[model samples]
Target chain A: MHPAGSLIIFTVLSGLGFGLLAFLGAGVVLPLGWEAFVWFAAGYALAGGGLLASVFHLGHPERALLAFTQWRTSWLSREAVLAVAALGMMAPYAAGSVFFAQPLPVFGAIAAVLCLATVIATSMIYATIRAVPRWHHWTTPAVFLAAALAGGALLAGQLRLAGGLFAVLAVALALHWQAGDRRWRDAESTPGSATGLGRIGRVRLFERPHTGANYITREMVHVVGRRHSAKLRLIALVGGAVLPAMLLALMPASLLAAGAALGLHLVGILAARWLFFAEAEHVVGLYYGRAAA
Target chain B: MTDLPETTDKKLGLVIDLDICVGCHACVTSCKEWNSQGYGAPLADADAYGPAPEGAFLNRVHSFEVTSEDGPPQLVHFPRSCLHCEDAPCVTVCPTGASHKRAEDGIVLVEESMCIGCGLCAWACPYGAREMDPAEQVMKKCTLCVDRIYNENLPPEDREPSCVRACPTGARHFGDLGDASSAVSQLVAARDGFDLMPEQGTKPVNKYLPPRERDRATAAPALEPVGEAGGFLGWLDRALSRL
Candidate 1:
């Protein structure tokens, strides 16, 4: 829950990139020749660059290929496999569109579904972690997919679709925050229970094992200032959802407006994603005497 | 390979007694010392001699104050490490199949060679059991001294986890918990040893023995006047009374 910059960039950029690819594959918009080339390049860059950024988060980036091996049980593995599959499948469709001006409907449709599946797999990596109660909810995936769809629509210049998806994203984000706020308490993993001292009495941490921070404390016990988080939440909502939705609704045909909306939305999503990791209260923090607020 | 075995032949784990552990951190230091040289990777420290030193440690002792209506607050030294759960979320979350549970002894371990160090396994653990090594950038956890536990090179008495061997108070017990007749299982049954965060449903193999209740009654006995104070005490008592 340290809110590593690499992961924040990876999720936000990849989500948007995949979202755009999904729309493109669905035949939502068809650009030909040089126009198609620009569109495909942007999509691949966002998606590929995001994937590349995620590799930086790994301690052994060279061994990342092995990550795709355990798809049977690991969501992270599934995510890696799905991402490669989505990117590989989209290649031919992108080539055809740029060269022959053919949309390649069949490949586009399959690639679109794979693109969405890849995003879902990415979300599932966090959603399945029961240790972080805030993330272990249906709303996690809901918010992720909503963000992807809305951001994708905005990038594709599909104002009507973007407007609708933005509304859904807003609802999903609200629901995710509302539920996440209560999840730690709902999980009932208090310091007493964590130490198994609740049976006798109330337990309070008296002394930490070490004087300095360790890996667990650095990774899992990140404490965000309440006021800071509140402001970020406002930025996420206003910039990510409200402003962009308003822009799309008011200036439905303005390419400049769409570009501005996309920019604001990315900033908003970045803030939201930061909050997503920073606000997460891992159960491990109970050992360090940091109560989930 | 990340999938857990249907059943492990043995559930080897630790049973730490909160009643006896004094938070000495002997086990903590010994664990780090033994594991650094014994197993996969040396426990790495960043800025060890500098300010803001951070390191990876497999075992740590946390001191907690427990207060009850019947008695004043008491300090409990709790040692935490990998529980080696029957359903370890850490193993299943490993992206590279580096994290795996032993079918033979039920010791969950990371195969360092395959570790990508993405840290999903650490996130899945609720107990803060796994720490990413600063130097190696790979996950480090309690191996239960796997090398020593089965090592023919060591004497029979030393064939246990370094933590268990280092504990001065004998609070740490390591054995096969799967066998109900094992000393650890019997101790758990007798002392009402319970899992940490049972709600998480990891079904942890490691168990903790709750601290025994403290005597709340005053230690000093009430003073009673003898029929007459004797000798110097009597004279002093009479003198004080007169004053």
Candidate 2:
């Protein structure tokens, strides 16, 4: 879990983009004239940008097309396929809703469902990493889904919807943080369990396998100190959720408040996502003397 | 293709004896030499001749001291590589059909030509078994010497993994693990060999033999003075002087 910049951007941006599309597709927001096109265009842009950013970190970016073909098993593949389907369906729905001013009820409904599924699939890509106990819990997906919905509501300029989702999102974030912090405190895997030497006794590393960091060490052994984690957690809470919620409450009084809330929320999520990657303890880290087991 | 087989015909794997491994890296070097020139992409190194050198290696040996309160501390050398699990998550997580487990032999391998090198397979592997080669933009790992083990051109005696063939102490053993009557299987049963991470439940084919304990009575202890007869000039002191 290197906390790669590209991947962070991909996850957060795609989540918001897809979330916005879900709202629009379901006819929750009925924008007139050019506003409808703007909403759809912005959603597509963010979603597509996140996807392109994801490819940036791949060793073989040219072969990404083949990724869609493995949806039968790979969650990453399923996400890609669903994202494309969501975008495809959104195209016609947007045309009908924006150009003809007649929302295709059936198409909109299907597109909305696809958008939500795409976001869930994307969340599952990280949530299913069993080696990282913090991310493996059901809380991971709960936080991700809530973040998408809340972010989507805010960006779509639906104050009441955003207000409601902000409360739900707050609860999800608190739960995710509590569970993740507990996991960090009570790491069940030790070098003994990781190496299967627990039957002998408590296994502690006497020597590391290498002098310098190797691929496993660099990729998986992310050690965020307790104090630093506390600070970041505070920032994620105040900025990602609290500040946005407060700003949205005042949005009806001032148009500038919406933009401020959206901006603060995005930055807050960046910090949160960074913590997400930084805090995950991959089991391989046990071999490096970086994780419990 | 991503799904594992319900049953494989023969489980080909290795059994590493922790007792005999001397921390010598002969297996690691031999693996690098053989695999760099054969069957797959070369195990490339970055800044190999520079101040800080980093590279990809298939087999690695680690030495650690395991201490017990009642006895003297023991230094154990652990040789690590792929275990070729029966239900390898590495194979299941590959987005392309590149990573697969052989239904015939239960050996997991990556088809480099089809690999997208997204590194998901590496993340899925709990053993830290997968290696990504930056040169080919592909994932490389211990193939169990897939090329030589089945090569008809090679001599029958040479038909083994490079690590097993090059082990100086013969600590690494290879055989058909699927057969209950196989020599390796019998060795495992006799030695009480165990899987590295049974809790992960990947059902690794490879097993490790725990080190045998030294008998306290047979172990050498510091020589005590032979009473008032000869405090500094004891038989043990004389014997040491002779050496």
Evaluated on chain B only, what are the TM-scores of all the candidate structures, in order? 0.89, 0.88
Off by over 4 Å in 1: B218-243
Question: Which residue pairs in candidate 1 collide?
Answer: none
In model 2, which runs have C-alpha deviations exceeding 4 angstroms?
A184-187, A224-227, A250-253, A291-293, B217-243
| Residue B33 in candidate 1, Cα distance off native in Å | 0.9
Instruction: Please provide, for model 1 over B1-243, each residue's C-alpha lDDT reduced to its tens digit, 9 standing for 90 to 100.
Output: 899999999999999999999999999999999988988988888998887878899999999998888887899999999999999999999988999999998999999999988888999999999999999989899999999999999999999999999999999999999999999999999999999999998999999999988878788987886588689999999999999
Q: Residue-pair clashes per candidate, as listed?
A: 0, 3
Top candidate when judged by lDDT against the true structure? 1
DockQ of each: 0.83, 0.52
Which is the leading candidate under DockQ?
1
lDDT (10s digit) by residue, model 2, range B92-209 = 7778888889999998988888888888888888888887885787888998999989999999989999999999899999999999999999999999998876766678999998
